[model samples]
Target chain A: MRPRPPAMRTKRRYILARILPYGVQVDQKQMYFAVIEAATSLFGDAAVGLAQPAVVFCEGGYVVVRCRRGAENDIAVALATVTSVADERIALRTVATSGTIHALRRRMKPSRRHSGDEEVKIGETYFAVYRYPRQKVDLVEKGIKHQKSLFFTEADLEER
Target chain B: MKITDAGIRPYPAGDSTVARMALEAAGLGFDSAVAIGDAVHRPPGIEILRGAVIGAASVKEVLKRVRDPAVRRADIVYVDAGDTSFNRAVVSIKEVNVVRSIHAARRNAFDHVAARTAAEQGVAVDISMAPIIHLRGTKRQRALQRYADVLSLQRRYGFPLTISSGARSILGQRSVREIRGLCALFGMTGTEVTEALASVGWIAEPHRPVEVVK
Candidate 1:
């Protein structure tokens, strides 16, 4: 009898996440461990195994994680639950999810920068702000030589 | 589409100070946060609403406290769901804005009757993330299951639902998107999560005038 070919595997989904503190980079192994630990802690071992998560790529503050098709949300939740990587406090924000890497990469193009200076008031003091990213902001206070950082998001800027 | 965290306890009341906690919550992308403590100075660019969590052993005590001049003046009123009767009583009251920790009990806390009453009375149900973050092992599993059951009832009965961080400190707060993602585990869709977050605005002041008559 002829040898049978290996069974075809089910298709998977890839999630693109941007690690916070923008410049901090982590390796594939560390990223994979952090995700697995987070999923295990949140959903337990059986679900994590069922999700079949894998780190396909990790570099330049971005990570692509693959998981079983139906478990994309579970994996995304797990990724969000991760608060630390390599003993440092960090956050993984899901930028996009796709069925193929090409599409996800296209969707990950850099957003246009907002120019011109703005003023932000924190408590009783006011600071001159230069740039504000999704996680952190660059600000300069009066009479201060060094710039101070304040982390804020678009939702924080709304006046309710 | 204002994102609000309706259940945060600032320092002296909880863990971190009010200003620091609000700053962290704002940094996490919330437009407003209800500080469940005594009066605290508000932060710039963020709306800080005052609220109180009242836990009582009986219905009479809850009613008496709710009618008190000090308690009546709060922007939001959350009644702790301690027992089945208490839960039913709180949900049926039109003055009560939220029934907090409905899943804290070991088993299903509210039933179909309670759900219908809450929906009719315009009372919202809160699923606090605190217990899930604090509990472990089988206890955590049980809590999640209970939360799922409550969510199903909310879907069937059409009561307003709010998913809150129930955070005591700065580190405990999650971004609006993060909260929606976590809620996905409980079977809430993206639209449903947005609605729940938006529901906070209405539930905080359900009877407010939409526009001035004059």
Candidate 2:
């Protein structure tokens, strides 16, 4: 009988290796994972760009990621994880630190072309993204299912 | 009650998939189909049948099949078979087109020959029709226009021509009577409208949803 190949499904997720929020450590990690998992199941493998302890823009009670590829189908599926496509036409209007938004604005200018992929961290969630305009995408494993493979823990991210 | 026009339909491939899809459509919203097919883009379902006459390898093959007369009991029959009367009131269709596929030259009946056969049959054949049309531009339309030279087969053979919007969407399918009326709008004779619809073996069984048969 022909054996099945290793799981080569089109999607992947990964957990962060650092402490995101200090005093609210364990609670923060749980909240972040819950949101990401919800985002993944509904959105399938195409919508998520990044993972936990990531700098995601929390706006209107929603998490936002800077996306540059795919559309509504991806958005609705990844609802738990707020994401957006930033084109040359629009700048990132994130509600994080004003500096973050300003930084994105400068780098996203038409002249400053990017590789079109992204990965960031904010409080306790790791925000990750697949590259924009990519014919193929790569997503990492997120949460406990992938805990063994992880090298970093919550304690590692403390601001010593 | 279910009617379709193939001339204006935007089918993916003009092959059996379209015909099967047409059959599937019968279940979705129709019980019959006014299939509009030509050798070039006609669906392959009829061809798949072992002895389906519509699967003739050539014009001669079609003639051979038609002459057999043993299997010609298409549920419905045509009245005039030329113009709108040749294929108008068909309740559903079996599409026979494959996108961008080459077709047998002799098998293509988008000409006067098929029309001549209908003309020869006279008023005896009863078929509702969705007129085979020719347009100035567009893929299928351009293809028709390219074959316009051969269309004389329908004319030379005495088959009449009519107009239809080849149905591809629920919004695309037209009412049989309204389509016939539209043919009349285009100056087709009454006999032409009746014969065209009957040509495709359209049956009125108290309006059942469309279905697909192997």
Candidate 3:
């Protein structure tokens, strides 16, 4: 069967969003489920079905969501409502929206660790520290699973 | 107008420090954040205003709580909303800047009377994005219903409305654009969100007639 002509094809819009906390690996399928759940709950099944939202790319701490052109705003709103993906607490900060994936890619700024990783102890618990620019520091309690995370600054660490 | 987050719990209350939250807030497009606890660090880029939360069963108790030195020293004061009569009485108090957590209050708790009193006393009702973002199913529905009711009352009575992220951690902090979107879930317009973000500034330093310094 021949594909539909370019003019007949459905117009699409892509939204780029940065996942907060800088470095949590996200499964694309799980991210899709999370997005669909949020959109359906907020806008109802009918509206979400019409919008046809899908997660096309989830990498480099950024995600590109594809949806119908007219539904980008509603979809972006739904993206903001996404609090977690696969039980991991997170936030999707919408960076930009465009007609093509290439345009959205230009907005992706890959997050890099600013300094060497280290360990610190407060009380009996130990935490692994990950440093970033702007004096931002993230501490993950040393554990095999469900580790508690703490957000602080360089000054906060010094005082501790 | 300075865009201010009406509520944030930093340091001992949460994992993030006040300075760290301030840094995140600056990147999220806020000029100031109201730290609702014992937060001492004052970050340079974004303003951190000391805030005190009063949870009381009676107006007399609220009055007593605000008199504490810590509460008195706070740049802003918030009260947890209670039932209808309690809400009406709390809004008229001069020291209270915002009535927060109205989403948890029962239906019609913040009625026309409370709105009018709040408007008259310059007390703003806080609309937090936490419920819309974090809650699901029946709880989220109830929160939306309450916010919608409050929005209608605010429109009719012309009372000031304030928007807060209610963030305890930097991960919970959202950008201004995201906040506008979350607020839209409850029928709030972009213009309304902007005004709500700026209402904290108004509450801090209300417009008044100038007096001669001489």
Candidate 4:
């Protein structure tokens, strides 16, 4: 990421989206890099110059942006792209899945909140589904409370 | 921005477990997160089995015990545990400030008070963790149906929201997306969903995470 010119300070808004294929080979090592890439694209190429950019967790994924205010929607829309076999929740593909796809989603964690709602099944395969906050007042202000954790129990796992 | 009760207060954090974790966590890595817990003071009490559990007097007391200016960097992910060790730490859950219970969800049906509190304080509310709504006349094979009934109530009340595990263990953490869904499930929309997922949490931004100067 090349350093942004002084002129690039002007704040920009983006309504981002993701149409990544639901079933594909997603490597863990590359997942982080891919997330970083996805995040970098949100702020164009200038906001984070060549410093390798940064990641701010947003909606079950890392949001690489300079500011939090304008980037919320963009981040939300981008992360909605994360696909799983459960339900079509979040920006990610939240649908119940079996086989390898399920395995990957299980491993792709560092969840944000809604894990409580996500139920896991079988073996020791760990899948993270963050229980995100719901109101505008909560997200930008004090933040969501704890009782509303993603899941109500530790054993809660999405049924297969 | 919205504000809510952070359950924070002054406490005697002198040589405390949480206090040490809070200090060692800050800047040790830049990548941060935030989660507010219910500010509580365990008082010496006798349960038939446990015998003694302590309690606190007030929220302020809990905050006082927190010696560090900031609980921990709620945002700014760090790659390494030591700050200044690298240009930046690309961390996630490792960066957390165990403050008050930030995960408690308020009842959407009667959330006016909660919403107002959060707005006044400049914070997000955890509507997802609100007390489970008991459907007086509804019974089903699973909790989802019951949970769904509560969600509708939340939607109507406009409760603040958040994501969490209510995990009995301290090491557990949730993802931002999952957190967002938690809010959405309770009928959060527009800016609320985004705010909840990004709220300064265990995987949030940096110090003064909400330093917009609101």
Candidate 5:
């Protein structure tokens, strides 16, 4: 065997984020570009370069980003600022962050799936609705677009 | 710590209805949100405080309006800060809870005097996130710089700073963590951002003993 290669010393941190418009799937490359663009816009070229952000994984509308250890917050902010991807409006909510993927996964609760049907009022009219995971709700409406969906979280229905 | 988005505009003109906005705020983990409009029906689960945005061209007009019973009773009184004289006058008064949009003007609207006075009188300076989200290119850069300057002055003078979405629609509104991250871009540390968010409650109820988030 050749001489053992020394272990890489670069310390890194992982960030767990949930892509909103929930169920809208985006390519990992697109998510990566959006994040980089946001970081560049917010912190300028030089600072973002130092952060060295990279999308390590993307699946099921969840993304894991890796960056320099101390740059987690910078990267998280960049991810938050990404309002769109491939011209589609979206939101990336930072859920959990950790030095190890194991820890991050442990901290992240399982995403709940919205099921069954309910009646919702939009404007003055009432429409039958179907629920899905990731805050996506589908409403049956006439004379609209291809689909009528609303992504709302529990906070959207909370009482004062 | 209770997080609050202290400057949300709702209703027919805005994208989200007041009830929806309140629910969205609560869902995003905000304890309360101050809606900037006439007192409307309250939503459940979250505290929705009624607030007003007073835009006056002169100091006298602002002073006169703040004295009005309706304006005084409002949970938060946000005066337009684009005019230099108006900004100066607003910061001098303790009753004026927030001076809104200091960086939206053509020039740097706030100066050393205003910052100092704001600190002395315990007036919270409102830095709305709407312009930053809407403006682009050089305009956006200038706004960011102005905001950084305000943050620096805030650090030096110990003035209260409250960050708001200034959102006209539900999409425009940001969660508390998102706002804190944006503030970090302007050079605020995590601790500083926490304090800024906490200031919203203090400004809304100055008489109550407020706890500062570490």
Candidate 6:
């Protein structure tokens, strides 16, 4: 079967969003499930089915979601409701939206972890701290799976 | 107008410290945030107003709670909304600044009488984004319904409204743009959301009649 003509193809819009908690790894399929669930739950199946939201890109702590042109705002709103992906507690922060993935990609400033592999112990548990720009520090518990993260600052770590 | 997140819990009660949350809030387009506890670490560039939440069974309990040293020093005092009679009575109290958790209250708990009283007393109602962002199914739907009811009453009675992230962590806090979209789900217009974002400042420093200083 041949593909549809260019004029008959659906015009799409892509939304750029950053996955919060800084370093949580989310699969593309998981991200799509999260977006679809959020959109469907918020707007119902009829609307989400019409919008056809899809996660086109998920990498470097950022995700680019594609949807029908007229439904970007609704999809963006739905993205804000996404509190987790693949059972991991996280947030999706909308960065920008565009007609092309290139424009949205331009807005993606992937956060780079600063050079710091420090360890801090609070009570009996130990946490590995990852530092970022603007004095933001994220401490992930040292574990093979299901690690707890504590968000802190330099001052907070110093105080303890 | 100052764009403020009405409430955020940091440090001991939450994973993130006040300083870090404030830093994140600044980047998220917030001018200030009401930290709802004793936050000694104050970061520059953004204002952090101390807030006290009073959960009381009676008006007498609320009155007594407001006299505590912590509550006295707080820049804002929030009362957990109760039943209809309690709500009507709580808003009229001089010490109460905001009535929060209305979503948890019964449908008739914050009716027209409470709205009129809140308006006359300059007491604001808080709309928390947590329920919409975190809760699902019936709970979230109930929260949205409560917010819509509050918005209707607010419009009719000319009462001030405040929007709080109700965030316990940095991830829970949302940008102002996201807030506008979330609020739109409950039928709140952009202008209304802006005013709600700025309502805290108004409650903290309400306009007063000029007096002669002879």
Tens digits of per-residue lDDT, candidate 6, A1-160, equal 9999999999999999999988788999988999999998899999999998999989999999999999999999999999988889999999998999988878888688975477999888999989988888999999988888889988888989
Per-residue alpha-carbon lDDT of candidate 1 for residues B1-214, written as tens digits (9 for 90 to 100):
7777878887555535566567677767888888886755766778888887788888888888898776777888998887666788778776788888776754656888888999998888887776665555676677778878888898899998877888765556777777887777677788988887778888765676588778
Candidate 1 per-residue C-alpha lDDT over A1-160 given as tens digits, one digit per residue, 9 for 90 to 100: 8655545657789999877544455878988898898889888899999999999998766889999999998888788777667875566778788999998887665533454367877666666644434433433454444333343334443421
TM per candidate = 0.68, 0.24, 0.97, 0.27, 0.78, 0.98
In candidate 4 chain B, what residue range of length 10 has the lowest lDDT sum? B45-54
RMSD (Cα, Å) of model 5 = 5.5
Native-referenced DockQ of model 5: 0.20
Task: Select the stronger candidate by lDDT from 2 and 3.
Answer: 3
Arranged by lDDT with the best first, the candidates are: 6, 3, 5, 1, 2, 4
Q: Please state the CAPRI-style docking class of candidate 1.
A: incorrect
Question: Which 10 consecutive positions of candidate 6 chain A have the poorest summed lDDT?
Answer: A109-118
All models, DockQ values? 0.12, 0.01, 0.82, 0.02, 0.20, 0.86
Best by DockQ: 6
List fnat per candidate, in order.
0.11, 0.00, 0.89, 0.00, 0.16, 0.82
Cα distance off (Å), candidate 2, residue B153: 11
TM-score of 6: 0.98
> Which runs of model 6 end up more than 4 angstroms from their true locations?
B211-214
- Which residue segments of model 3 deviate by more than 4 Å? A114-116, B211-214
Give candidate 4's iRMS in Å, 1 decimal. Answer: 14.5
| Model 5 CAPRI quality | incorrect
Candidate 3 residue lDDT tens string, B1-214? 9999999999778888899999999999999999999778888989889999999999999999989999999999999999999999999988999999999999999999999999898899999888888899999999999999999988898899988999998878889998887888888999999999998997888898998998
Please give, for residues A1-160, the per-residue lDDT of candidate 4 as tens digits. 9988956754433222221221122344444454444444433455334323222222234222222334444444333323221221222332222222224345344433432344333234333333323210101111232211122111122212
Candidate 6 per-residue lDDT, tens place, B49-84, comes to: 999999999999998999999999999999999999
Interface RMSD of each: 5.7, 23.6, 1.0, 14.5, 3.7, 0.7
Which residues of candidate 5, in runs, are more than 4 Å off?
A: A1-6, A99-160, B11-13, B17-20, B23-29, B39-41, B59-73, B92-95, B131-136, B168-175, B208-214
What docking class should model 4 receive?
A: incorrect
Best by TM-score: 6
Per-residue lDDT value at B74 in model 2: 32
| Model 5's interface RMSD | 3.7
